[model samples]
Target: MVRAFKNTLIIFSSLLFCFAQQEDSLKVGLQSLKKIESDVIIISAEVRSGNLNPTAYRFSVFPRHRPSEVYISRMFFPGDSLQVVLPENILDADSLANIASLEPVGGSFEKSYKLFSKQSDVIDLGIFDVKKKSDIVKLSVVDGQTGSPVLKPTIKIFQLGKVLYQTVLDSSGYGRLRIPIDRNREIPLYALIDTDGRYPLWRGSIEVSQGVSSITLALNSMSLMIGESLFRVRSDLTPFRKGPENGSEILFMLSKDDHIVISRSAGNKLYGRVRLDLHTKKSSNFFHGWIRTKDVEYLETFATDTNHD
Candidate 1:
């Protein structure tokens, strides 16, 4: 009886801790949601503890691209008031912020401005016309300082608010996208890099027009993961904005066994991957594999067993 009580206490404690974390996260998200009230918003979070003394860490806020009228967002530190954190060094970092290093903190148009066919600005496959492909928005991420193509990065497509498709970017940092268009569709279509939920380093948006034949968007140059692996991948669901998350959950079980990746490990801890694996399933395309966290966790448990033995 005592042992069962102890286990119950442990589970309760874990659940309470998780609840608190989620609540705090929601508060932070609320702060962010209040700030974006413009067409384009760019924010960067910088951690500075260096010789720069005036402000240790700051964030640069861009309401628009004028460069003159800048708004620095306030980073709330628990008990502290929401203080403006965007100082000079931080802004400079944003200008040169690499893909992996830059923990960006901004979002474009709110849920108000429509970005697609008369629907909300989220990604859900069910509401879209599956076969209606009219416009193709192409963005090529490249080295920022050097005008060369960034080879590989993970890119995802969202409709409504769900992930429809994702792929590793090609040698040109380009993810060729096809989104269906209806006359009711509005402008301000969003393009984002899925790494940390960032706005498109480059973008394309329209005002939901009725006077166009077919539209093509070209994204500006940006730097992504320099060492991100570019493995051969094939999937029936390409990064089309109008595809289902999992085609047929019952056509096969949703087990984690199908996933495999060539991830590098650091001292029994796997951070991510620079060289990944790709597999071709039956009657489908070969698609790049993800670093399976479940597999890694299982490995960690096995390592513990090995140590005990």
Candidate 2:
């Protein structure tokens, strides 16, 4: 009887030891899993647009190095927060931050935000406001000299040197755009009209009022004297010199899409004038210099009967 009791006690002790070892192993495994999870980061943000259908928009995250490998979230409502998971080491040394974009379906009106570094594993971006399509204003483009509508014009609206909206006008030269309004009830925006090389590029700034419904853009005609002709600067940062010689001093630089009125040509050089601001009426804004004929492309000639003596 004494031998049997000792055997049973030993067996119980061994079983207890086995159970303790298994518990320790499980604890170590769980710790390793948690350590791996800590190497990742979570980004969250709430997007809202007043009275707009939130289902029409989606969120996306573009990794800095691998832009093609994007992370997208499911459709979220107005009040719901968007979440994205990324590895902590996703940012490289050359990149400052990753880019997150909120885009609507079937449209190019996208808003982007930068994802910066955070010490915490979770980063929360505050509410992001999206502009609604209902905040629109009608636009009418017409010729300043002729008072005729510019048919089927390509229009681009800019704010702070960034393109906010772009669309082509209909046959009536009319289009509508959603203008973002600020707290001041007025926003200064620029409009660029392209008539398919029919006229010089028209750029002008206008003050948009929140209460205004429609605005008209008056584009100046490309007018030149009898001896003058129109040429477009073909290259960016082309040098405009003081004289026709290659050793002449560079008076200024002209960029691509800038129009020049050429009066005469000497050897490989052309004397031309560039209007600094076509919308402005100041005569001092006209800068005349010599540009190489290789840098400009002839658009049209403006010879009239008045050139006859």
Candidate 3:
């Protein structure tokens, strides 16, 4: 009987020991895992590389909810450690409908971060200010470090949520984006560029600084061909600027002679929209430009910021 008791105790103890070992092993494995997230006036998302290469890559931050899909595609890199800026207005959060506190990662890429020769923290939106002859969008970027300006890496602009203008900067590291304002204002403008991964180095919301003096509407440059109609906003207080460019009836005859200036652009090719001046209430004219390889090249080559390069 005693021998039987001893055998039973030994079996029980062995089982307990094996279980404890497994628990300890699980704890160690958990410790090896890393978690990165934050709340408040900031966002830190894991950068997943859907696709990558020496010249370009596809990347994005998650919470993709809509037709936008909101991703970074075709990110050009010079190859280096990159620094990115969180757009001041991008703290967009929504109360979850009791979805899990944290969304479980479906899957992830191999590398946590990447390095490139040319990385950017500053956002240089390539645009032409056609608003007033002197229209300008003044933007400042803070490096991953203190509020210093990183002088490398080029900034590209994606309007209406995609790239339309792109320019390289000079030694000063300042990029001048001229809306040259002659496009559709119906859609909101979204800026994007990769700092290191496949996402914007910097993104933000900007508007014409308070008065007419900040920007000038270049009326003389307005050339309406193909019966493009220019529309004028009835009011300046509201962001809604309606006219032909804003999706109104195109009165080709009335729009031809009207001189409209470029306000902002949202996209490229047939998918793009341009916001024009608000002065032409009677016309339906807006921007219709070609953004081929040559157009992209012209903008990049003529970039005012390239003096240093």
Model 3 TM-score, all chains together: 0.23
| Residue-by-residue lDDT tens digits, candidate 1, 18-127 | 99999999998887775543222232222332221222112233322234554443433322322232322323223322111111123211111112121122212121
Candidate 2 residue lDDT tens string, 190-304: 8888886666677777656554488887765556777887888887899999988899999888877678888899998999788765335222267889999989888754334
Off by over 4 Å in 3: 1-134, 196-200, 208-309
Candidate 1 error regions (>4 Å): 1-131, 163-165, 195-309
What are the models' TM-scores? Answer: 0.22, 0.50, 0.23
Backbone clash numbers for all candidates listed: 19, 0, 44
In terms of lDDT, the poorest run of 10 residues in model 1 is 109-118
Question: Of the candidates shown, which would achieve the greatest TM-score relative to the real structure?
Answer: 2
How does each model score on lDDT? 0.34, 0.72, 0.34
**Superior by TM-score: candidate 2 or candidate 3:** 2
lDDT of 3 by residue, 1-309 (tens): 999999999999999999999999998776655211221122222322323222322333333243144422233233322223344334224532111011112232121222111112333222111112224554443343244554543556555666645665444445565453444555555543333321113333445432232311111122223323333212212222234244543322212112222223444311122334333322334543321111211212112221111
* Overall local distance difference test of candidate 3: 0.34
**2 or 3, which is superior by lDDT?**
2
